[model samples]
Target: MCGIVGAVARRDIVPVLVEGLKRLEYRGYDSAGVAVLNGDIKRVRRVGRVAEMEAGVRAENLQGEIGIGHTRWATHGGVTEPNAHPHVSQGLIAVVHNGIIENHEEKRQYLRQLGYQFDSQTDTEVIAHLVHHYYLQNGDLFLAVQQVASELTGAYAIAVMAKDQPGVLACARMGCPLVVGLGEGEQFIASDISAILSVTRRFQFLEDGDVAEVRHDKIHIVDRNRQPVERKLHVSDLSLTSLELGSYSHFMQKEIHEQPKALADTIEPILEEGFSPALFGAAAAEVLPKVEGVLILACGTSYYAGMVARHWIESIAKLPCQIEIASEYRYSETFAKPNWLVVTISQSGETLDTMEALKFAFSLGHDKSLSICNVRESALPRASNLVFYTRAGAEIGVASTKAFTTQLVALFALAATLAKLKGQLSVDQEKQHLDALRLIPGSVQHALNLEPQIKLWAERFYSKHHALFLGRVLHYPIALEGALKLKEISYIHAEAYPAGELKHGPLALVDQDMPIVVIAPNDALLEKLKSNMQEVRARGGELFVFTDLDSHFTESEGVNVIRTPRHAGVLSPIVHAIPVQLLAYHTALQRGTDVDKPRNLAKSVTVE
Candidate 1:
């Protein structure tokens, strides 16, 4: 994942590009670089955070109205100044890339044979050469990118600038997100909203095959086939306040408290007046009547949301749903029936892997494909047959909080909606879950209130490097999310294993130095969790648990238990997740990570 920002502005673009890059720093921080077309072509790159890299650059000499910049996480290359983005080739052109180039070796060899020398190990280097090669052949920057992009395979979102034309920037996307923002006498382009949010709110979401040519005073669009297309102007709703830390020490803490509002915002539209799933009556009739099984695809925290939804989907909808990581689903070459429903979940809606996986499923003729995403204008939602919008409202933290819970809410709601269409759910069953959902905001509020206690616990264990989380069934996903939160922010080597998998191998890693956080709510698996606790205790593991008040966690000498509300089995995980998430957030804060913008992470994984 990386953050990319670029501009073709009428005014001095260096300051605008710099400001935009600063806002996007949360997305990726391993290294940062910028390329601008001044009087003489200028490019600066370094293997460090933005602040470190920027401090050493010649701010006065870096003059340009057209430029591109990137903060990288090093998916395809080692972290070095050469590996840093804004890769330059043939003297004038520079390109910054986000996603993986699955077929880079062949392209690299092809370029080498054609007498192009590369300085970096990045799959991105091929692009600079390709663009340079195309320009040399065609003498047109726009046609160069379009031609080079056509020959390119695998996912990429690239922004290129040429010294031959200092007032324009050319960008393209294939299986990645690129947006064109329209400002007065200026046009902006970036991987997502944050980069251009500082510049303009007016944007057009670039489609998969579209190539955008952003100039200082105009923006042009073209189809993959080179047909001219009209620019669709859209006003983004992102406000300045959404970009601020807003008195909170960390974005996770801010988002944790925003859950009540986020959950309420998501459900309010459905709860308004006499709302019904019949709003999707047409889709319900067409899809649920034929859907045989479900293929749920997602990545990271959204993947965890999908995992939790499988239980509800199987229990309530009675569908055999298989949750697959998006990166795996696309290339697995499975024998899915034509009537199999495919659902992709993403918080940003621009998750590169998930979008590609959904597109692959669609290409394979899946009868129905749907998306649940926070961003309404995102590519995944637009391409899917049905879209469920999650109004989580701008999650800025690199590690998700409200976005994860809201995705769970959206997926569970979508499952119920499907079940209602299939006539599998009784009226009472539907009403009960609906009632429980309505009360969830209050439950979430209560969970957020327990942050003080979680902070105290975090202070005690923040210094540890190795931590593990364990849970069974539904809470298994929660355990994974907890581990992700810790690892993403604290840089802690943490893993989440299924509670039953203790003896399989991970048991060997447990010791006094390892802090094991167990999600043991008062469910049917309480006995199983109790047995697992003994297993950890047997191995001299130090346990820090978020268990229900009614849990059978006795006064054990070597373990510590933090009590939570003894809620229902179905609602328990959602309630129980808050404290552990809080624990991770505070632990990272105490450990002095840039909690909102951790090292080598970004708010949106637009590249891959």
Candidate 2:
């Protein structure tokens, strides 16, 4: 994933562009660059953080009224200055692109036949050359980008500025997200709204195939077929304060602490008004009774959330459930039951794999679709038949925390709603579930109270190279999530397995050096989980158990017990998630890794 920010404005936009790239730093990038049109394209690039690029800009006194900036997560190229974005061609055209061009090799060979020289080993460099080739023939930046876009294949969002066409910026999107910001006597474009939130909030989200020519005062838009169209303008409600680090050392730590508020914001309204199928969407009332089963599709952390939802939906709603990785689901054949609800979960809702998978399911005749997302204006919600917005606000960390907890809260609410609709849950049962949901914030807060102890555990974990996590039944997905968190931030190799599967294969990897984390809730499977822990202890494996207070687990030789709050039955997953998140955060802190933006990871996966 990469970040793009462009502006056609009256003021010198170098500072703005650099600041925009700085805001997008959390998206994970190996290099930063900016190109400005001042009679000719003046470009500066660096193979490190945005600060390095900003310093280079300052040293060179680079200033221009119109410019484009990029923070690149390397793909199809090495982390070098030549491979950084805002790639220019012949000192005439400059382009910054996000996403990949699948047919770049063919395009490159064709362009080489035309005597166009290549510079960097990036798919984006071809776009700049292609745009230059078209601009030389047409002498119109907008039409040139349009013509070049028609020749390209695969997903991309690109912003182009030509030296011959000053004060104008051309941008296009196909299968990747781009937003146009409306400002006074200025215009802005970015892959994410947060990149330019300090400048403006009013934006127009470009559809799958959209081309726009942006000027200081006006913006012209056209569809894939070249017909002019209008997109609705939305005013984002995200405040600048929410994006700040406040007192927290890192965004991951801040987000881990924000889980309680995030959960309350997601489910409190539903709890007060009581559950209704209409809470999901206006059509849910008609669609819920017709739903025979559920197919959940997601990726990364969201996929694990779906895994947990499968258990809830099957046990509570009395519905058959299936979970699939969105990336794999799109490429494989699936038998779509017409009555089965296609549920997609994502934090940003712009995950390309999940979005494409949702379309694939729809093409297979699965009509009903629901999206659980945080961003209200994202593409997934617009494409879904029903929507549930998780109010976790902006999760800037590459490794998700509050977003994951809020999703579990939303999914649990959905399960209860489905159960009530199917007559599987009685009135008293629904009330009890609602009460338990209300107490989730408090339970999460109780879990947060164990952070100091978890931080101590982190001290032991930071130096460990390998970790194994074990859980059973409802908590198995939490174990997977915990392992993912540790692997993501702390850069430690971690693997999770069902406790029952430890003997089958994973137990061989266990030793005194292997730190084994076990999630022991006070459920019926607690005894079985204890037996699994004993198996680990017998193998000279160190045990780190996150258990409920009543689980009757205590610390001894090579054993460490961190007690969570009393189990809140159905909502235990949300509570248990907090300690693992803190553990990852503090461990990454001890290891001195970038906890917010881990290496080779992006906050949102907008490309395949």
Strongest candidate by lDDT:
2
558, model 2: CA deviation in Å?
2.2
Whole-model lDDT per candidate? 0.81, 0.91
Best by TM-score: 2
**Model 2 TM-score on a 0 to 1 scale:** 0.99
RMSD of each: 2.6, 1.0
Q: After superposition, how far is residue 547 of candidate 1 from its true place, in Å?
A: 2.5
Task: Give a tens-digit lDDT track for model 1, residues 479-568.
Answer: 998998888888888999999999999999999889999998888888888889899999899888888777777657777877876564
Over 52-153, each residue of candidate 2 has an lDDT whose tens digit, in order, gives 998999999999999999999988889998899888899899999999999999999999999999889999999999999999998999999999999999
Off by over 4 Å in 1: 57-61, 102-104, 109-115, 273-275, 278-285, 503-509, 549-556, 566-569, 599-603, 606-608
CA deviation > 4 Å runs, candidate 2: none
Ten contiguous residues minimizing lDDT sum, candidate 1: 273-282
Q: TM-scores across all candidates?
A: 0.92, 0.99
